[model samples]
Target: MKILNFHIRGKMAHFRRYYSNSSALSYSVPPRTTLIGLIAGLLGFERDSYYGDFDPEGCRVAVGVCSPQKKLVQTLNLLMIKSSNDLNGSRQHHSQTPTELIIPANIRTGFLDYEVWICHQNNDLINTLHTRLEQKYGYLTQGVSAALGTAQHLGWAESARIVEGEEVAEAQADFFSILPVSNVISLHLSESRHRLRLQKEDMPIHFHPDRTIAGKGNFLINASAAPVNAKVKTAVRLSDERFITWMED
Candidate 1:
């Protein structure tokens, strides 16, 4: 998948890491953050596009998060399972209920070197996930607002473009947002799919060892999101030493 420079914008957030314009900026999250998906009944997002990373059983996917908080991560996993059940609880009248949360690893890294699983298959589940996130966490886009579109998500758009499997194409309605909290920050992206087609040559430009797991044929919409909800001023002035300390912990 080709990576395109992208951005997103919300009430008071924008992703600056990969954004190039004012209207588009979202959160800047570390790579491999856990992304959760609820298996709802209606069609959510396309499979190739939303699926982050799959497991041996093909029942779970990996998503990178900003930190390694066990309690925080487990809560999200459990919530996804419950939401998924609410969406597709009675499919074909299956009995053995699916495990609500699947912890792939006991100790995981925050973004920049970690991944979480998301079981997204339909829009209803996506909606449920969004609502749950918003409620549990006061805000989901803080880093973007604090960063003003110039942080970790520096090359996300370019990466996303490649995912479209196209080259030298034009897209409209691309936006970015940021969500920063304490020593952590997350980036969010939202844009129009119609304008993000790629050419053959552009596909080869986006190949990173860390990003290869997604592989080809996996075309996820450029809605890169994270859970950064740090306070404002403190987030913008995060010192390198402080940032490092946060990650190490």
Candidate 2:
């Protein structure tokens, strides 16, 4: 399978957890759904109209964090709307609610960079996306508008060259991408070497309402203080550095 590799970066990002209510929590990396939305935007697909175009059966996506990351929780005062019909009355009814927002610690100079791997059975779609990203013309003039969680936090991407990759037996490395817990052949944590930590999250992969389920699943993400030794099974190699597994059903 051929995979298109790309880089995404931003000063700050927040991938909100769906289950969080009052306090919005964020995922460490962009979920499969977020990736789909980004690609759809670049393709100029209407909102909620392109879910099937990038379904798991046809397209696979993987993401890896490329920078040191830290999480911080902050509160924002948000206005609550009670009635839209009564403008004068709505002001009296509206109240400022303090909402907790989970965001990346470095909101200014500290950039959140990620390596993305996208593999699709359709070669034309892949070529178009790559060409558009590289030229930065037509639909992808400013690059696709990407956000970690909310639309308020914006990011950009450029065309990343695709390269050949090889599979190795084992190596000590920090994982920057989300992987299926079942596909992980083996994992080793070293506090002195890698400072590795494990985080498990339930992420939504598909948004098509027609499906029996919305395509939600659990994913295991690796967080490392530094790179660690690991034995991984991956089908595609990215940038001669990272190995990525396909997002499967």
Give the candidate number with the greatest TM-score.
2
List the global CA lDDT of all models: 0.24, 0.66
TM-score of each: 0.19, 0.79
RMSD of each: 19.8, 4.0
Q: What lDDT tens digits, residue by residue, belong to model 1 across residues 121-170?
A: 34344344344333333323323221212232221110111111221211
Which residue pairs in candidate 2 have backbone atoms (N, alpha carbon, C) closer than 3 angstroms, thus clashing?
14-149, 64-176, 64-177, 65-176, 172-229, 173-228
lDDT of 2 at 22: 65
Model 2 scores worst on lDDT over the 10 consecutive residues at 95-104
Error of 2 at 179 (Å): 2.0
Query: Once model 1 is optimally superposed onto the true structure by TM-score, how far is the C-alpha of residue 182 displaced, in angstroms?
Result: 33
Best by lDDT: 2
Error in Å for residue 223 of model 2: 3.9
- Give stretches of model 2 more than 4 Å off: 80-108, 136-144, 165-176, 191-193, 210-213, 224-228, 232-234, 239-241
Q: After superposition, how far is residue 95 of candidate 1 from its true place, in Å?
A: 47
lDDT of 2 by residue, 23-117 (tens): 77778778888887887778778777777788898888887766767677666644455566654454453544333343334555667777788
